[model samples]
Structure formats: C-alpha cells, structure tokens
Target: MIVDKKNDATGVLLRNGHIVLPDKTYVGDLRIRDGVIAETGQLEPEEGERTLDCSGCYVLPGGIETHTHLQLESMGTVTADDFETGTRAALYGGTTTVLDFATQFHGESMAEGLARWHKKAENNCYIDYGFHMALTEWNADLKSEMASIVEGGISSFKIYMAYKNNMMLQEDEIYDALSETKRLGATVGFHCENGLLIDVLVKEAKARGNTSPWYHQWTRPPVFEEEAITRLETVNALLHADHYVVHLSTADGLDAILKARSSGIDVIAETCPQYLLLDNTRYGTEMSEDFEAAKYIMSPPLRDKSHQEPLWDGLACGDIQFVGTDHCS
Candidate 1:
C-alpha cells in the first residue's frame, strides 16, 4: 500500500506490486524510516523489523471523506452515532480524514457549541479530523466569531435553507454569513432547499392528512431546490464569495449551479452516492410514511429517477467537484 512515511519514527516500507501516490505509480519496494516514506521500488530488507508482501493489492492514499454528520442533535433528539462511533465507522470504511460540521443550537453561543463538539471528539477519534461550523443563527456576535474560529483551524461555515422551522436563515442572515465567511477567507457551504415555501407545502400536506415519510419528498420538490439555489447564488454574488452546495440531487438544482457559474459566480456543487444510487420511489410502502422509516430520512430527501442521468453527467464531466457518502451512521 502507498503508506505515509511521516506516521512513525522508522517511517513506512512497501514492497511487492504497484503503489499509487497522489500522482503516478511504481511497482517495487518502498522503505520508510521515522514515519516518513524513505524509499520506493525494489529494495533489500534491513536486518531488523518485519516485511509485508502486498502481492495483488492496489496501494493508494487513505481516503479522505469530506462530509459527514455525527451525533448531531435534531428535532428534540440526537442522532445515534456519536463522534466516537462515527469516527470508528469511518476508519472501518477505509477513511483517514473526515470533515464534520458543528452545529450551533438556537439560543446557545456558537463558540460553546464548537467547544462541546471538540469535547465529544477529543481522544476519541482514530483518524485525523476537521470541523466546519454550521451557522443556524446569524447575529453580530456569531459573525464576529468567524475570524477566531478560522484562525483556530475551523475555517469553513455553512448555512441551510432546507431545515425549515429549524435552521433556515433568512436572506439577510444568509448574506451576513456569506460576508463574514468571505472576510475570513473561509469557504461557504449551502444546503439549498427553499424553507419558507416548503413549510407552506408541508403545512398544507399535514392539514390534508398527508404526514408520511414519502410526503417529505413530495412536499419539497426539485423546484423548491432550484429556487433556493437561485436565491443563494445571488447572495453569494453580492458578497463575491465562492461557495459549495452540498449533496445536490436534482437536475434543476444542478442547472442552477451551472448557470450561476456561467454567470461568473464561484458555485461548486457536490453530489452524494446515495442520491446517485437511490431514488425516492425505492422507499416503498414500508419505508413510506410511518414507523421508523424516519431512519432513512435526511434533509433534501431523495429525488425522482429522472434526475439521475444529469447527476451522473455532472460527475463524469467534472461539473461536480466531489462525491460524498453523506453517511451519518
């Protein structure tokens, strides 16, 4: 395997078949000392230590999973996976580094929320990690906290337009965050689903006795995502900020991002494997509206099948910047 040499005093050593670095590959032996990779290609074994024979394995860098949500508190409950279990699961999946977002609970200080996440992760992670603060509340104090947070290694910040009645930020609040993150040289991330409009639809659906899991996607269609994306793009433009849209699942949403970029806005979007592989209709009757089907629930819930082609095209043509599992558990 392509091993990191800086992880130990004796470094790393690899031999046998092929190893893939960030770029290029060599078929031979690699030697590392003191944790840094010391040599590569066919090598003679030293007198001390052990040797591993990787005859038919593909040696590559440890995977870096850039998006995940673990132990996040939501809707009067906390998600099942805490940082410990979450990080462990990531390691088990072959991920080496993960970037999870820290949430700012309503009425609590953003700094306090970040500190709490730190305590949850401290001494518990089996791999390297980073944080991106999720701004649910926008105010002068929290906006000002961005500078120090970026200085302290928590640089990226994201705001949601999807978590209506919970985390949706009004236009002014979104602009505040965009401007603040731009000032701090931090990238902004977006969850683009029109909250206000979806709330109306959700209320209407519930009033009509349509409160089922499938109604989740039924109430908030791709049009709402498109509208929210358009709104956020305008705000980001005013701030002259480059931002990332996370887990984009619909063609309309992708088109909004592409159009924004065409207009010269720095709007990078990412898709998740779930969206690429799963469709809304697959939820079936059992996972439809009742019971614990909520277990399969996520914000910006799965979309219809027609969008999959464009999603794949975005990935294949490199219009999408990256793909994440969006795996919380």
Candidate 2:
C-alpha cells in the first residue's frame, strides 16, 4: 500500500518497513507531514492520517543528483530535457534535489548566464534545484563577480578543458579562476580532456575520410584525458584548492587523481554509470552502422572494458566520492 502525499493533506504513516538511516537500518514506522518527514521509529498513525503498509520495502532518504544538464545549449543544440522534465524524472527516481549547470558562454557575463538559467528553471522544477556556474571565460570583470555570485548562493563552479573554441579556457585563465575560487572558499569542477589535441586528432581522422561516429572515440582517446588531468593537477598542486573532476572515464585519469590525493591535494572525482557499465565496444561495427553509436559520443569517450574494474574498485575504496549520471537529458 502507498499514500499519495499530493492528494492526502492530513499526512502519511508508513508501517513495518526497513528504514535506512545514516548510521543504521531497522524495521520501523515512519511518518510524513506537510511533505517532510515528521517522525520515525515505531510511529503510530495519528487520527485522520493516511496510512501505507510497507511490508517489504526499503525506505531511504531522497537522493541528490550532483550533475545534470537541463535546458542547456551546447554545440548549436539544446539538451532534450528542460528543468521541468528533468526534475520530474529525478523525483520519480527518488532524487529530491538536483544541481544543474548555469554556463556562461564565451562572450557572456556570469550574471547573465545565471539569470538565463534561473529564468529557465523558475516555477518549473518539480523538486529542489541549484546551479553550478560554468565559466567559459575569465577576466577582471568576471573575477570581480565571483564573490557576489557566491554570496548569492552559487559556490561551486565548472570549467571546461574540452570544447576548445566554444567553452574551453586558456591555462592562465583556468589558473586565475582557481585562484579566485580558492579565495572565495568555493569549489570548481572540471571537464578534463585535451581539446587542442582532440581537434588535431579529429582533423587527422576527417582527412583520412573516417568521419563515422566511431571516429569520435578514436580521436579522443583516454590519453588525452590523462594528459588534461595531469595538467590540472600541476595547477592545483601549486594552489592547493579544493577541486572536483566530473565524469572521470579512464583508469589512467583515476590514477592521476589518486596520485594527487595521496600528495594531499584536495581533489575528488565522480564517474557515471555509462563508464562503469559500458565500454568503447559500443562504437564497434554493429552500433556504428546504424548510427546508434552517436548516442555514446560524449567527451572523454567510453573506455576499454579493462578500465571498468579499477573504477569499481575506486568507488569501493572511497577513491571516487560520488557516482553522477552526467545526465545530459
């Protein structure tokens, strides 16, 4: 049995379920009032309260999705799911909160980008939401706005090492942004892949007339990801700032992060299910012929199956802190 809080204003009482809490788990009763958990542990149904029998269910806290791209414009296209659809899907999956990126384009102000995202999400999201500002360009003016943005509740930021002409920042610009974020006590997330090298590789592939989607994986191999992460490590080693690596896809990149953390650099990372459960073989003959391979074309493209075990081990040992979907939709 289940109670629909949307229809029942009185409240809900759930009985005889496995309640999972931070420190322990037990079979207990839980109550919710006004959409928030009101009590737990052998709770009794109040007068006029709605009740649900949870004989064999695991009641847990709602999830927080740390990475998502909703209603975002990139590479001449916008992602399929806007805030409304995306947040609704998240809620259906038990995720109660989401953090989507509000990206500042190359010539745009950070504030303007933030405003654009707010306009897209306002009164549209089905659950709690927040933004991580993705800064494409760093300048005196943009740096000046960091404090106010942080004050306005956007404390984490993102920078791309890929997407060269459209979103990537120069090494110096990245360094300066890191410096400013460190001073403001904010965190920065990175999309680490060597964009310039990828461009050269892409041109080489096209010149060979290998323009199929399979070439997408071939051109941007794991080495480029390792190289970019190593470069960022060098920068962060000097600054000692708290940083996050998003959608880490390769074993070599994970090794670099492990090395950085061992040396006391405050760096953490996340990998998506695609990296753990899928592999580069998706770009092989069968999928590519149908253009289904296009679905797997993403930055730091999927890696060899050999990389999966190490990533799983990393998660088990706490080397990787979170598993985000990098949910583009």
For lDDT, the strongest prediction is 2
lDDT for each residue of candidate 1 in 15-88, tens digit (9 for 90 to 100): 68587876788777767686556767778877664577877766666788878888887767887887778877
Backbone N/Cα/C clashes per model: 18, 0
Give Cα distance to truth, residue 318, candidate 2, Å.
Answer: 1.1
Q: Return the TM-score for candidate 2, rounded to 2 decimals.
A: 0.94
Query: Candidates' lDDT values, in order?
Result: 0.80, 0.89
What TM-score does model 1 achieve against the real structure?
0.89
Clashes of 2: 0
Model 2 lowest lDDT segment of ten: 1-10
Candidate 1: how many backbone clashes? Answer: 18
Model 2, span 1-329: residue lDDT tens: 11234666798999999999989999999999988998999988899999999989989988999999999897689999998889889899999899999988877888999999999999898888899999877789999999999999999999999877778887888889899999999999999999999889888988988877777887888988889998998988889987899999999999989888888887989999999999988887633556677788877788899999999999999999998888884
- Give candidates' CA RMSD values in order: 3.4, 2.8
**TM-scores for all candidates?**
0.89, 0.94
RMSD in Å for candidate 2, one decimal?
2.8
Candidate 2: C-alpha lDDT? 0.89
